[model samples]
Target: MPVDRKSLFKRVPSGIPGFDDLIEGGFPENTTVLVAGGTGTGKTTFAAQFIYRGAELYDDPGVFVTLEERAKDIRREVKSFGWDFKKYEDEGKIVIIDGVSSSVGLPSEEKFALEDKFNVDNFLRYVYRVVKSINAKRLVIDSIPSLAFRLAEERQIREVLLKLNTILLEMGVTTVLTTEAPAPQEGRISRYGIEEYIARGVVLLDLQERNIELKRYLLIRKMRETKHSMRKYPFEITSDGIVVYPSGEIY
Candidate 1:
């Protein structure tokens, strides 16, 4: 039987300024996407904008699982863009899970001591409960690396991610997961590179020096079951949100 590929997937518009055009309307519905970039590359901002726009423009409820920053802090940061996350919370349009607060008092280093305790299963369950409670159509796990850092073993990290992917897919909710990339000089997509393997799509944000100025560029490196633009597009972070200039030059 010939497969009706179009019927298999739906597009979920990110609603970020000038971003959806690159991916042919939006991300694939109910698929996990990795938004990988280095420090100061606006990964959180991009994810937040996607969630905010989903609720504001598309009428889709979203859940933000913050692994690093506080939920209140995220709300404060996005206030400049005129997105009152708190108000959305009050109306049940959005929910922010404080992954950081829950994991507080843990060591900040990459290695965990033998006495330290971290439960990936419990965290996943908590997130699952929240998602179900809100009936969220979209979700954002801000920085998978931060959550993985709490675990000591590489196998544990991979296992948690695999389980998370399965859980999100089963829920039929589109997800955007952020991960820290290697240094710009290394030209790597992510710090561990495992996220790209498990995700259905990968969007890379990078900052480069062009004409003695720092410029941001966005690229859809890989998106399963869809053909996306391969060319690098210049973008900027404004008071409104992240804006990509498809026809603009980086230099």
Candidate 2:
């Protein structure tokens, strides 16, 4: 008898509307995915939605490690989308890990705060401890470029992320690691140009001049182990959150 490899993995439903169908119902379990985009491309919203929807709808706990914005600011920002991150955090369904306060030498009001932002090992251990505490099933590390600021060399950055990937896999969680991508480039996908290779999947969100307007689009540049859409699909940021039109195409 032949073996079905994909059947060995379970799908981790992405919370974004119309998004999961494109990726075969969701991201693969126990894999780290990279969400890369330029400014105003809704990278944060997509990643946040993954954490928020996982906790609220699926009964899956999540950990959102904000690297760019403070935890309170993120909570407040996502409130407009009707996704109450703080509410879930309060209920122990999710954790908003404050990576910002430690970077700027400030005290975070959030329950979880990284004590040392400069040491990659310390940051990874802190995340490990918090994720285990909640038994979280989904994880998001917003904007890896901010994390790059903590390290002095690209080698160290890659090594740290590889370690982080291993940590996420060991915990059996589907993770979304966000990073900033430069504007409409030919080949450059991420700010540091090294993040795409570190994760098992890479999703790109971009804005393009289409149909006489600047339309937002999303593409799965690469997703290892599972068949996924290769076309640039249209998406929007609504009051509810991001919604991907899997059937719609751009260009």
Candidate 3:
């Protein structure tokens, strides 16, 4: 009797092993997801894997926009997991857009560095060109808070998020955006407090000390279409990448 809206849209696999099961095969195609976490909580890995594996497994090209960290640094970090980001770049499977150097008044060596950083309009145009060039199906914005340096007002930040989401969706690219989540005591899931509102899904990574042992946990706080677990799920950063135990609960 009820309609299944999910049937109306196709799903794109998240590309992270064991992570797709939590979201019913994958994310709704072309939707935006926000991945929030504190320092060293594996947010970067999660987002990178989404881009890498999407290209590796599903033949989905991707665009990774590094707003805070250098694209090379992110590449080096993910290389420990055996992912050769350079190979993908060479093969035209992935584009690592440098958004950092311009923001810092330095010239970028990246092939896809942004000419005008912190300007949402410029960023969107660059994204459009890159996505079109690669026919990218997935995209990533490393951290939303980094935009705060130039966008001093909350309204401006929110508008940037909205425009980013709208542009990404219009381009038909499944996007995963990363942001810093303050500590549990801060009472906010995202640094800006508005990133989650503009996304179709929100996955928060948390590092908590339990029984004197530090553990990594993931929570699917909000997803628009598919049924997802609200309970925090146990995850780990193994030699490969982030692995989420869909059935395991933190309790």
Ranking by lDDT: 3, 2, 1
Worst lDDT run of 10 residues, candidate 3, spans 146-155
* Each candidate: RMSD: 4.9, 2.1, 2.1
Q: Tens-digit lDDT track for model 1 on 113-143? A: 1222567777777778778888999999988
lDDT of 2 by residue, 136-192 (tens): 999999878888887877567777777887788898888899998886546788876
Q: Identify the runs in model 3 with alpha carbons over 4 angstroms from their true place.
A: 1-8, 116-118, 152-155, 249-251
Write down the TM-score of every candidate: 0.89, 0.93, 0.92
Residue 93 lDDT in model 1? 82
TM-score of 3: 0.92
**Which regions of candidate 1 fall more than 4 Å away from where they truly are?**
1-8, 106-117, 184-188
* Global local distance difference test of model 2: 0.86
Error of 3 at 128 (Å): 1.4
After aligning candidate 1 to the native by TM-score, how far in Å is the CA of 208 from where it should be?
A: 0.5
Steric clashes per prediction = 0, 0, 0
lDDT per prediction? 0.83, 0.86, 0.86
